[model samples]
Target chain A: MTPDERGEDSAIDVPDALAALLGADTVWTEPPDIADELVARIEQEARLQGDDQPRPAAAGRPRPWRRWAMAGAAAAAVIVGIALVVNSADDDDREPAGVEFAIVGTELAPDASGTGVVQVRPAGFAIIIEIQGLDPAVPGTFYQGWVRSDDGDLVAVGTFHAREDNGPIALWSGVDLDDYPTLTVTTQQIGAGTGSSGEQVLVARFDGS
Target chain B: MTARDEMAARFAAADPDAIRDLYVQYSGPVTTVAASILRDPQLAQDAVQQTFLNAWRGAHSFDPSRDIAPWLYAIARRAAIDIHRAEQRRRTEGGHDLDVAVTPLAFDRTWEAWEVRRALGELPDDEREIVRLAHFEGRTHSEIAALTGIALGTVKSRSHRAHKRLAHALRHLVDTENVS
Candidate 1:
């Protein structure tokens, strides 16, 4: 059957609506400098990756089938990693609802901001934090989310890595939030233990409302 | 070899110049895709950078024999979605003025829009102009003929061909997505 017969409007004369949706005139225009800037950034990343590990020898190339097999293996590994995160987030044991807190920038990290949400249920609490506008965590360093109580005790919730593109990094935790009345995100060097790094970038107070 | 074939080879070889060439060719459409999702030009630019960086890192995985445009387009769309999610969180947390009346575009619909725009960009100048007139200008076939001083029959023929090509391209994208 034709698309029209199947009642699919998207298949019929898509160009007209598609053109309007894309804003055909304005969508194609881009700043002239963006290409150069992107190329420079890619080169920097390539150089950094190169510095950390030696390049594979140009000789001793594998056959096409073998190369394809290697690529498939690498792709599979990546898919597995992503699936792990997805599965963990979809765990059936967690509560399906939560209270959200706006995590604004502190004086130190003027540009940093994020949100922390705590889901409470009969089992426990599940906390999810989404952060953005933070600098990329340097090698051997990471950002750790902490919850502080009224009496000044700090509890480490979770750690996350920020990328250069400002893509939000979401960290999940199951720590109870009843005692902790405040949330603080801090930058910590690797192996800094579970203690507070004292370099807080974002803070939000929870009033238990 | 064609320019695209040469680019594919260079990309697989990790040639830095190829990275620049790919960016020049694809950045505009990538930004458009991002901007459509995020509704912010600056955030869209960030998505563009992320898209190309991802292309550069994954260049070795690309099949040189296949068309690079669709692959790059897919990455751009994903980057835009990432930005969209991030921006939504920001707006929700910042308590920005979000219009409740307007229905937000679904993720699949946004991807389709991006794909259509990318396909439209691949058309020849005359075909693109005809399609743009029909869609963007809301002109009928005869109106397009009168506006461009082309014959009515010729305008109708070109429009039919452009629509067919667009549908075929979009169908191919759907097939690819289903396979993967």
Candidate 2:
């Protein structure tokens, strides 16, 4: 309803006045450190996806970091109409709680199995995998996930480590799932190269419902 | 390091040094932003660590096309808000002391704080909050997104553009010799 919410240039003078008062650095942060923070947050969120257990709480208990991958592709409503989304969820914390996101591509290890629920909706999606009785893998190898098409082509939706809390692993990037039926999780080494080498872990089928 | 190589290197490596690099670069600003929102240094520190840790784990997901500051700041904002909410919950639930000390401006008349305050007032609440997070507390866009639970891309785009707008509005004051 508001002009700014519509992404239209509001009375330029008001914005200009605020900018003049704030000065350059206060407004536009060109600091490389901010870049570093961005890089670091993205990486951590990615690794958390493959984590199979709850990380020991740090001395400084930090808030959970969110990274929604493949949101643009999965949530056409949000992506195609970003402005409407911007207008809708102005308060990040107060926004809808149960919205699901899409996972485009992922690969699960052959032996991997358990129920995994992905919250896919307009904005993005998060993944929660429940490992029934499987023992967590050793540090060197991790359980990775992928999305697959109907014909069985693997798509790198994102990766994750198992968790103890039964909380779903959140994706940090976009996954390509144009012609996909399900998501797969697998075991792989940390530095042991690429793809799922250990075994199939689990799969989540999508009926497009 | 080549820009591409650096980005790739960051993507590949999740070492403490890499983490430290992030801390050194954005900590101060993030602290400032946290302080503005939470008004507590300790909570601010926690927000910073969480922000960086999020960055470390989520590195692969970040799009190179976007600037990183706003995204991080978004996280910081959310974290700060969370802290506030938790504190409020504690107060309401158990009747805890709500005597959180807000940092006061020293001069109360300094043109700098005044200008910032005035500009902050001029902004819409959302834009003002983003500005406060960036200028007063020092969060990057990614941190802001994580804290706020908003999309990282949206945080970066809006915060950056907001900064530009604020800067344009306040340009005349900063340009004045007396204010400088």
Candidate 3:
């Protein structure tokens, strides 16, 4: 039956959800350089409150503090930083979302390849999209990039015409990548309404964070 | 007092470095719990940052005789929910609000995830890599050997060792009923 019923280990007796989560290759993505931020925030708050209590000096030793017995093994290793994963669906609100998505061309442009470097700034989701081997957005038409949600909602990041020497294009997004993980580029006619023209030129799906 | 009790006492005193010490120690599992609720990595991280800040603010009420993990977990859960609600409101402001609220995982579900993640972090680098290849990536022994450049026999042995260590390290997840 199960690993537990098979008399393996009691720990393997996890529920299906727990087992799946354990096997999932995701560590909770922490933002880069958060510790420094935390330290600064704490110090600032302390000062604002006029906290004059003597503080302990930063320690470099591995076992400077004790942990809950249950976390003995995990906390013993002196781990510091975590893998950084950025998702700026709506906030594009505050911090940075820095996952890179490799954009590839569809049947329309087989030789196209580039990347979307996402950043979540206060303005919105800034998607720095660049696809090589694409033509310039001519006078009557342009290229528009979209981040599509799983539910099929699309938010246009930006539009550009890739000239011979035109560099990467930065498009803004109003959605979080967690909810909208797909990226698509289409050729938009000058007056083809505001909808995706469906003349697919490029597409990139964020397969991972 | 136990080392944990001492730390909690210092935390209640609002020692910045002491809290940093606590963050260094517990941030991983704390974020794991928060991420379980929020599902957004950056938001989960924000919840964690706020959790420590809230803990510092409310440190005066902490009972040094009690465990800091549960107290911090309570604060972390609140911070995550608060962030989730804020994100919901942001979506509404942008006219993208959904009608339903995201369901929170069962306490044990989050706890188990936290424990497994913590235990995985404690594993020796080689053994952890083996587990990642075997369980996480679903790679075969020979496949793991080719991928990781470790010998097949050694891979098998490390797999066994890793499983053993995981079993021992995570026994509390199964044994405890007091977790909330």
Candidate 4:
């Protein structure tokens, strides 16, 4: 039935409706916190199961491109760490779903606000910065991303601006692993302006392998 | 709490404060869904935590007008199911747990709900999201049009088509299953 057919009732039994989308055994999982003790038990079992194993990277390191929102000082590193562990084990439990893609290290780019994930494949790393909250640069001004070396030289990765014509821009391309250990993006006021807007957004960096 | 209240009080800007509260609020429902599928409590908590972390990064993608529960639950369900199914595959591929073949059905009144969920998953992402908001969330056609920022007519027709495809895909299951 369409939305019109169902009317405006807010009482739809969504869990039941989505049970099929999730398969039959999914809904009974509703209610209760799954118990803290149970979680601890599972963690212990998981640890025991993988006790002898070494993880691919250190825990809680944010992927590139997910750091834009962190300009405000949010420590998303731990969040990223939890994610890697889960993604590593996802295929073992659920049916495959959602759009799948591959990045060769050049496809990653900053969003319209010049923020996004840097795809670094050789090092087995990728990270994204939150960009939904940044104020867009005005006309005659644009955000440019650069790869900075320890010697203070800067290499241009790309440049972008916030515009209504383009939806939220994201750097989806992958890039070379060595060119950019320190990645930064700055807002260049092309027209006559004072000092830096101090709005250069440092999106994300790669984990050195 | 009201949906607006939850959004404002728990997730104003996706900081740790909002993330932590959001975790506490939905952790119960998330845990329940995960545990039901994995049949393991520890696995369920990990799944719930994963779901919240996902919501944290992707909360910007959420439409504020829609109910947060279903959206969060859906993500959690997928995580839990993924973990459970992956475990199943490992056990079987390595030659274990051969006794279980299919998931047990969870309800009686309508297999239609289950069928709809399955068909929605098969639809392209755009169409699937529209059907989910319209049918599963009980949003009015206008409400869906506004929340998704899509045309109202598109929402109407897509939902209908989604239901039609659901019935077709589930006809066999309906016939054999003990659906009321």
Query: What is the C-alpha lDDT profile of model 3 across B18-57, one tens digit per residue?
Result: 7777887678778877777776655665577678878888
Every model's DockQ: 0.17, 0.05, 0.12, 0.11
lDDT of 2 by residue, A1-209 (tens): 22233443342223433333343332332222233333434553544444433223334632121212223224435433221111123224332222232222224333434554344333234454455545455433445666777787775555544534455555432443335546666676543455556366665554333
Better-scoring candidate (TM-score), 2 or 4? 2
What are the fnat scores of the candidates, in the order listed?
0.25, 0.05, 0.23, 0.22
- Candidate of highest lDDT: 3
The full ranking of all candidates by DockQ, starting with the best, is: 1, 3, 4, 2
**lDDT values for all models:** 0.60, 0.48, 0.64, 0.46
Cα miss at B23, model 4 (Å)?
A: 2.4
Candidate 2 segments whose C-alpha is farther than 4 A from its true place: A1-209, B1-17, B101-180
Span of 10 residues, lowest total lDDT, candidate 3 chain A: A62-71
- Which CAPRI quality tier does the interface of model 1 achieve? incorrect
Candidate 4: tens digits of C-alpha lDDT, residues B61-142? 7765666756776787677667666657756887876443334333232233333443444577776666556544656778
The predicted structure with the larger lDDT, 2 or 3, is 3
RMSD of 1: 18.7
What TM-score fits each model? 0.48, 0.31, 0.51, 0.30
Candidate 3 residue B169 C-alpha distance from true site, Å: 2.9
Residue-level lDDT for A179 in candidate 1: 64
Q: What is the lDDT of residue A11 in candidate 1?
A: 39
